[model samples]
Target: MSRIVERVRRVRFTWTHLAALVIALLVAAPLYWMAVSSFKGKDEIGANPPTVFADHPTWDNYREAFADNNFGTYLLNSVLVSVIATILVLSLSSFAGYALARLPLRGKAPIMVALLMISLFPTIALAAPLFLLMRDVGWLNSYQGLIIVYTALNVPFAVWILRNFFLGIPKEMEEVAWVDGASPVRTVLTVILPQARPGMFTAAIFTFTACWTEFLIALTLNTADRYRTMPVGLALFGSQFTVPYGTIFAAATVSVLPIALLVLVFRRAVVSGLTAGAVKG
Candidate 1:
């Protein structure tokens, strides 16, 4: 009977592992196809029997994309806007999160609810209002407009992440800092903030990804050719008559590299941040 039970447990574990592996493959399939198609020649991309792997991988799509399509400019703009916006989000969210987590303020519950509701509001609904506001401020077609909007959109989520992470930290740490004659700001800067690095990194990564891939906002606000982002420019790769699949795929693959590298490098921190937020004192 013991051996029968052990056998059943082993079979159950195998089936569970198989299910996880299948899910991973399903998630990875689209990314794999995009990356593979990037290297395939134009003819192969459109072939009815889609090539899973390129028989003759070529660099022409990447070359022509950057050279003729202004993809480099778009990439640069995305990087600048994403990095700047992520910095703003982390700085602002860190403070707001710490406050929300630690301080006893009037109407805190209402404020938290409002923030969560605002985040749930669809981006499409804000398009018209945001465009008008940017136009009135003369911020259309500029970097700051994009940066500011991205920061606002991402702050609520970042604040939530950091707030939960902060809650999990020992409350006595703040009291000890106060006993040492540290001002609240100094305590946050020197003692508490350093310990919140994992949460901060998680916020930074998420904010950067949102800014980097944002399309509707980037399109509506930034009209100048030089200021276009990766998503906007990728759309233009296909003309009215011709849609170049290879070129689009190449650009997409290139665009995914930075985010992939970021995740790979700080994956552990991200996991820690996410899991740490799951518990609170």
Candidate 2:
């Protein structure tokens, strides 16, 4: 019986691994094609039956993309906006989450519902109002305008994730800190935060990704050439006459690197955080 059980477990594990590999390949194939096509010559990119690999790989695409698009400036703008927006989102979400999860706050359930509603509200509906507001405040085509908008859009979701993660932690952790004379703020900082590191990392990843890849709001607000993000910059690579797929893909490949590196670096924390929250409220 023991030998039979071992064999069954082994087979199940093998199947699981096989399924995971297949899924990974499916998701990665498009990204792989984009990366490879970035290295191909402009004419080769438009081949009738697209080449799986570059015929003669060259760096011309990268060079031309940067030279034509002020790509470095756009890259810097994207990084600045994303980093600042992410920091604000994470900071605001953490405190709000702790309050909702652990504190004696009134109407917590209703507040959470309200947050979900706000997140679900259509961005397009608010665009005109937001544009006018920014214009009145003289913030159009500015970094601060984009950062604040991104933070507002991202914080609600982050709070929901972190709140659930916090609920999963034992109350005794905070109680112990309180018993030792630590205040609420101190307890949260020294006790809760260290234990909640994974949750924070998870929230950070989502916030950063949302800010990094956000296109619509960025395009709508930052119309000035100097203020535009990479997505906006990449969009202008095509004209009525021609679409330079090779250059666009080259820029896209570079743009994807930062987000990819973030996920790889935080893979363990993100996995634990996501799974931990799944079983909680």
Candidate 3:
């Protein structure tokens, strides 16, 4: 009986491993294709039977991607907007989340509900209104415009995530700080916020990813070529007459690198933040 049970357990583990492997491959296939295609020339890209591996890999795609246009400027804009927006989201969300989690205030429940609902509203619906508002304020085609809009769009989710994480922390932690003669602001700044690093990192990652990939708002807000981001820069690789597959694929691969590195670096914090929020004090 013991021998039979051991064999069954081993078989189950093997099957689970096989299933996970298959799922990983399925998820990685497109990314693999994109990376591989980036190295191929124009002919190999549009081949009748798509080339799984390039017979003659070339750097011309990357060369063209950088040389023929203002890709450097677009990359700089994306970094600037994403970094600043993420910082703003973190700052605002941390304060709001702390208040929502720890404070006694009138209508807190309703306020949280309203914030969640606001986050759920479609970005598409706000495009026209946002465009008009930005235009009226002369914020159109500027870094501040994108940063502000992205921060607003990201804050609700950030607040929700951070609030839950904050709630999971013991109330006694703050009480101890208060007993130490720390002011409420000092306690939050030093005690509560330090313990919430994982949650903050998690929120930052989500906000950065959203801002980095956002296209419609960026496009609608900025019409000037120089102000465009990586997404728009990639789009410009195509024209009325022709679309360069190699350049697109190359640019796409390059675009994925920053985000991938970010995720890899913060993966542990992200997991901790997510699981911490699922628990209640």
Candidate 1 lDDT, 115-174, residue by residue in tens: 889878899999999999999999999999999999999999898889889988888998
For model 2, residues 1-281, the per-residue Cα lDDT tens digits are 99999999999999999999999999999999999999999788989998999999999889988987688888999999999999999889988999999889999999999999988888888788889989999999999999999999999999998999999889998889999999998988898889999999999999888888888888889999999999889888878998888888999999999989989999999999999888898
Error of 2 at 54 (Å): 1.7
State the C-alpha lDDT per candidate.
0.91, 0.92, 0.91
Query: TM-scores of the models, in the given order?
Result: 0.95, 0.94, 0.94
Better of 1 and 2 by TM-score: 1
Summarize candidate 3's per-residue lDDT along 1-281 as a digit string, tens digits. Answer: 99999999999999999999999999889999999999998888989978789889999998888887667788889999999999999999999999999899889889889998998999999999999999999999999999999999999999999999999888998999999999988988999889999999899999999999999999999989889998988877778999888888888998999999998999999999988977742
lDDT score for candidate 1 against the true structure: 0.91
CA lDDT for candidate 2:
0.92
Question: In candidate 1, which residue ranges exceed 4 Å CA deviation?
Answer: 1-9
The residue pairs found clashing in candidate 3 are: none
Question: RMSD to the native, candidate 3?
Answer: 1.7
Clashes (candidate 1) = 0
